[model samples]
Target: MKFQTFKVCGLVFAFLIGSAFLGSSGSALASQKVPISFNDYHGYTGTVKYIKSVAKAYPNITKLIEIGKSNMGRPIYVLVISNMKTGTTIDTFVKLRNKRKEGVKNVPPMKPYQGKPGHWICGSTHGNEYTGTEVCLYTIDKLVSGYGSDKEVTRLVDGQTFYVCPVVNPDGLYNSIEKGISQRQNSMKKDDDGDGKVNEDGYDDLNGDGHITWFRYKDPKGRYVIDDVDPRLMVRLRRNAKTDKQLYSVIREDRDNDGDGERGEDSERGIDLNRNFPEGWWKTDGMAGGRGNYPTSAPEIHAIAEFFTNNTNILMAQNYHTSGGFTYRPMGTAPPNQLHPKDVAIFDMIMGKKYLEIIGEEVPEAWKAPGSLARFKEELEKKSKNKYAIARGYELPRGWRASYNEARDRRYGYGMASDWMYMQFGAYAITTELWNPQKDIKDFPQFTGPDARIEAQRALLKYQDEKYGGKLFIPWKKFEHPELGEGEIGGWIPKYRSNALPGEPLLNVCEKHWQFELFRAGLQPEIVITDAKARVLYTANKANSAVVSQKGDLVSIKKGKSKGKYKIVEVTAVIENKGKLATHVARGAQLAGNREDIVWLIGDRDKITHLQGTKFQKLGVIEGTQKIPGYTGRPGAGPAEQRRMQRMPRFIPPGYPMFFRMRGARLEPTQVKQTGPKREVRWLIAVEGNTPLKVVVTSQKGGTKVKNLLIQ
Candidate 1:
């Protein structure tokens, strides 16, 4: 295939000139089991069907779960992709002591995939931002189809789990894509105009053209003027700007359906689902800050919140949006100071670096040379006015930034999903605004200066003209409006403008994001029981209770005689985190309903008796194999800055002596030392009749692993 770029009417355009391959390539097509096409958008119905097909086709690696339903009763789904037979949870191995007599079926059973580390990927939180839906579907196709074919994909599917929700707002997505009306919020039954009826006056296809496009009419007070380069494109004049061209008023191809004198004011448009989360939904003035009556008030958001609450294994999450082609990490509702130093390094140095590289953005110098962050911080202090930037050592890159308005010191919005996921759920959550025409499209000319937007619009119009045969745009046609009088009805189809142009451009955006997510998935903490051993120290025909007494430097245990055979066994197990990141964020375990990593010794309840260590021990946190670049905090670091400096690494600096005394006193370093991810746990137990022993390690996000011990 050959492609060329040329200048046309002050705009650079590229089109498919020719191709070497005459027919479709076997490898290019989707899996034979579930075929998908990116040439067009797949609304709610298509998405449901495709996911159902995938779940049916790949039963071993996929399970379709309906997390919740939308206001319109559409099922919101999450497809779990993992080796279903391979994982286990703590709840499964540990039996509950008491059972309630009342039949209350509130808690659902945990799935096998929930036992493994989880990466959540959801799209279409906003109905009109359906580009996210396609990206999610593309990611799903990549995961499912590449499972057996790609090595990395196979490992991820086998070890980790992916919960991909294609459409978070089903009614909004369906109305936008299927009904050809740009509905950005979820659907509701409330009457917006309060005309004693629900959903009475919405967008109506006045011209009966199937699409609810724009209707333009000449008006002296209108803010828009016909573009000189591309007459079809509407150019909005700058505020208070004088324009000689005829000003026009543009509105959706709609009218007053219920004779309310208002146009589409009482439509099914509901609360913004993204703003219906539980975090920062309340204002300081004791008022409702976000959409709906309260946080998680909308059915969609409530479902999501409930799902995250139940599924604690998810450590990484992504909420996809469109147009900006950038990612927003957490703390959107607060300033940068709220984030922990360790988490900041992980989100920026590791994940943000990879994201910038994937999107072809320059990484910050501080990120590249994290060891010299202090120097960078000094340099930034002199030149940068942003306090957060000066403190952090570098300004956030354009491609990766927080939604918090740092310059003005204001929150971006209330009740955002990513903020909730990070602050409360303890996940490395982010919201990625996908799609940039100049970046995603090959040979798409860069536009700049005052006329940049108009020039880009012109170029895109021409590009679509050549590539899509002008099918995406509806040509302006004369039409008589019911109330607004004479006008022309036409414009770029609503879905095609804000979203990535389907086919090649959409595929490009999807691939880059998928690659970035794959890298992130590889970073999830993987806890494994590397070694387990059981050795019998003593055996007796009958025993009752054992008592231990210590004298001077010696300890002895005395056993009482009983009518049962007993063998005292020493069990030791080595648990290690083999992945690239820690099991939890700095404050993850400290959050409500979360706990530190734990290791348990399991056997028959009545047959085994713990003699030394408890049945389970809390492993503070199992760090990952990979070292964080810019982070210097050690295990004993305190919350206060002064205390953190006091508890530095145990190893002395080059100029310092191994042992040092302060103020004439011989102050020795603490004897207790905390090491790396590996932890060796031991338990002494009395086993009767050679009962089987098992060692289990469970981390909320690091995953669960169990090993059987052989008593020798």
Candidate 2:
């Protein structure tokens, strides 16, 4: 089938002739299982090469485009997969995104996916966190290959357009693959030890085993000891333990290069692309986790930030990571318990449900609830019948344990990507930690004590032995260290646990995470103006309120009998949100400065506009909190969107950019006090002519709608 492009229209013309596509080819309809050739998530030259081949093979459905390059000149490729719905969805979004950053005016925000809304999945940022990259590749393959072959796949691809950036940190991933899996930061070398040297002394395969494993040497003043039952594992010494035998000291597999007597402390200094985002960015010099001198200082992360912040059409976003079967959100660096109590409760409850459906994990509802501790007590008594109600004051529940250190409830992260995307932009952003070995075990033991770690080790080892013939773990062996003398340099290899999931279980992990991603896409806000109704003001009295001559999208009213030659008439349009979340989310509404949620009237009206530096005459915004109006809202008094948009899900300190769309010269977007759950906003205007009225309603979060009402 052939398609026609839409000509750009000025104010009053609402219709944007959507793009169209031909039906699938006969052979393209052949459905088959994802070829292991492309299905494997572990390593197939990364997503860099895979997307190109997929797009080439399926040109009608997939478009391979590069947004920018990484710090090391690696192309940052994005695959826009659509079902011939291409001309409208992908290009419009890309244009809007590009122009928004440039503060382009007169360009309308991209419409919702013509047939379905759009979704963005950021595969990976930390090079070593290979799970997200794998999942992204697997997902892209599923989409392009499964189209027309699988019913669900056909529905998804045909309905929704996907922007998949499989690997966000190309330099870092290549570094890990080329040097060692332990290479966590990207290739932007820095002076980690602040000694005015870069990449001077970092990890080395001290034993020349082609890997970077830890080293433990026998020493009289050591704080660790080799597990007697599992000599391959080492545990720190417990306090008050009586022992006479020589203990051991553990250090990373490296040698001191700066003569500082420290090993691996100043090696391969680079920014952790994940921690270099503007949100929660650490400004102090020499911060940990590869945080660069400034937020988005790295080329890769800055390009990504610039891309997504401008692309407001993104409904859901996920930054994939591996190990520890955990799903995390914003506030990675700050204390988790300090977020808005209600927001925390809602995130936990809603995210918990998704987790159970996807990874079979629990989000621990016993954590913290909304309202104060006193409110919790009162509700507990009323609901729990005072039997199991808490008699003491509220205490924050013991949070999750860190996989590497087994440290509990540790709160620390700065400049994490997920927090920026979600907290600032208000898009549903999730950083997924894939593969928790505990999920595969029955009676999972805790990592509380040395003995407990040994038991946990035993469980994992036994499982690995039974499952993969013990091929995953690198057996402990004695080796000679250059500076530390004789020691053991064997433990769980990077692939064995911390980094990517082993090749065997990777498929299952990808499948589950993909399902969760689809679930999120299903929840994206779909804006609708089907419920919009227009009325013309007729008359008013002390008892009889202002009336309209007729109702509908368009109605013409003549000058009324008010003893005057001409009389003004009011035209009110009611726009309703019919999606799950508010038109724009609660968080997005707060950060959307100047880019308020409202309906636009394009006609011969003078002085109306949202842009500040443009040359073209513009329409005026009526002004409200979230909309454009003149009422300070108080709960049930003002428009629903305004009441909700002003709230901050979490109060982050100043410094980070609010990633909102739309180009407005206002100091900030309107502060919305309310978001939604089936709400309506009324657009009221006064006009004199009987021309066609094209109204565009956009809820920064909900989809956009253009309705034409001809008035005569």
Candidate 3:
């Protein structure tokens, strides 16, 4: 059938009625339900139409950005949603909020705390996994439609920005739609069947039923026997318990279409997008499911990698997939015992509680499979210290099995998605199987009696045939098989089975799953500056009759009266990591320099004094000095002459130490300097005192002056 827009008129009417009760505010009034159903979303044109509808519906809040183009030249669009009033842009919010507190006053300041970190939700990384794309579309609709109406929605939108990429593998998705069967690889064709030829043959509809159903051939000695209780159910005889050798019944199909003895073994396959990430990239066959020889080998995967690399603000990730009824976390490949102790503890605390509340079960405490997206997220956290979570591998609900006794016992337990997330990224990632076809039935008990399970399968087939029409099962049809002569190609059709249910009920399930995903997104790590402080330390060294200043010559004594010269050299401050994590240094904080000025000098007729120290030591002089004959005099030099004098170092005795004092502060010299014009001047200094004595030293040049000197 051609791609047609299937409007759910009845569903939309019901939604409008229900929305009236839910919509107390006018914001919800503007939301109009589009006439699009998930069943028709198998085509690129349909997907684009839905995306455009969302964009046009919420133009003020939703913006569609073309991050890149797909191999087919289709625009890969990213939908960004944020509150305009708060001025909270995606990258801007993350960058500004991570700034240092001391530098908050400069230029543009951050907005007041909004109470949550920004969030990102991506979908359809796997081409065959189309459920996430539909879910993302629904989520966008919910967020925009409820912006001013729903309290929780408003809080989420205002508190954090949401970035959504609906389809990461559009090429694969489009191909699946056109081919009438979902293929896991991207659009690039390859020799997947391995017949030593490329894209030569693949599965064909031998029954001409417009669907690919399992084929069964009659064989008297078949290993598979019809259950005594239910003819619809087939059971394999155990190898050891078999009475005689029997034929094996594999999925019934002929390999080659043309009249040939050889089976069709070659068909096209594309790159596996999950294996194309940069974090745990492996060559083809080097890692589990690694498709290509290098990362970004596929155009679609390359586009996604480029998008994420540029948008570093994506803190949380959830990848949706088919039926398994469980929430999964991270550390995909590492043994559960090998997980980081602290990280494991945190993971248990968060996901453990969430799973119990949401799914009524806890994730099995074990390690998961390798080379999955969950492992990729863990590697990302290790590399950037940013948190990422993966919610994948959801199983179909058991409802599908309720109708058939044979299918009932096949229900599997929750698989990997949620656990992989918690173990790896420390964020809660959930994989929820959206729909359970086996609804309203108690968990199916294992059949112990003869033919009980087969009987159940017969009943299920009868119910499916009666209620959902013959869509669930293919009527047996005769076809001239290439090898089997005359054979019937018929069994279970795709959507009618439990795994692939109709779009209406599945969409509802997706809506609920999307809510949980939204909750997980809201909880991503939000790093903020809780507190900051600074401390200063002063060090000085003094020797007999001479002083070495560690912080320049802020202390000096001349003629026993204390100081004729003193200057504040450098204030040494060290920023400590008092918080739990390392704090980044602000861009401009005046870290290495003196904050004030004080000049150092010695007074005498010909008595020369020296100052020695290294430059850029955070203790260097102010690089300028003036000399005068007397303590009280006007300055005689300008900045030009001062600069010339600064080039020359004043070297004191070899062992002389340095002393330091702040400008306008008292100066107490521990050591004294003895120098005069050949005993022409005799000076006696007082040694004992409770407080340092202040002495103002003035230059004979009449312009230079120094204060804050004391004698101890």
Per TM-score, the best of the predicted structures is: 1
lDDT (C-alpha) at residue 466 in model 2? 78
Ordered list by lDDT, greatest first: 1, 2, 3
Candidate 1 vs candidate 3: the TM-score winner is 1
The C-alpha local distance difference test score for the whole of candidate 2 amounts to 0.58
Error of 1 at 34 (Å): 1.0
lDDT of each residue in 1-712, candidate 1, tens digit only? 1232334522422222222132223433444468889999998989999999999999999999898899999999999999987999887788644432234333566777888999999999999998889989988898888877677988999999999999999999999999888989999999788889999899888899888899999999999999877899999989889978899999889898888788899999998998999888888687888999989889999888888887899999999998789999988877778788888999999999999999999999999999999999999899988899888899999999999988788888888999899988889999999998989999999999988888988999999999999999999999999999999999988889789999999999999999999999999999999999999999998667767888999999888556488898999888899999989887887777787888889999788878777788778778999999899984433233343355668675688777655765633311213457888888888898978888988899999889988999
Once fitted onto the true fold, the runs of candidate 2 whose alpha carbons sit more than 4 angstroms away are 1-44, 82-118, 149-161, 191-200, 239-246, 256-262, 282-290, 333-345, 361-411, 441-450, 531-576, 601-695, 707-712
Q: Residue 364 in candidate 1 has what lDDT?
A: 90
Model 3, CA-based lDDT:
0.44
TM-score, predicted candidate 3 vs. hidden true structure: 0.55
lDDT score, candidate 3, position 459: 60
Point out the higher-scoring one by lDDT: 2 or 3: 2
Superposed by TM-score, candidate 1 places the C-alpha of residue 84 at a distance from the truth, in angstroms, of 1.0
Judged by whole-model lDDT over C-alpha atoms, candidate 1 comes out at 0.87
- Worst 10-residue lDDT window for candidate 3 reads 581-590
After aligning candidate 1 to the native by TM-score, how far in Å is the CA of 167 from where it should be? 0.3
Ranking by TM-score: 1, 2, 3
**Candidate 3 Cα errors over 4 Å, as ranges:** 1-29, 33-44, 66-77, 84-118, 191-197, 219-264, 278-289, 341-346, 362-436, 439-463, 495-500, 525-712
In model 2, the worst 10-residue window by lDDT is: 613-622
TM-score of each candidate? Answer: 0.89, 0.68, 0.55
lDDT of 3 by residue, 498-562 (tens): 33344554565565566666655444432221222111122223212344344474765433434
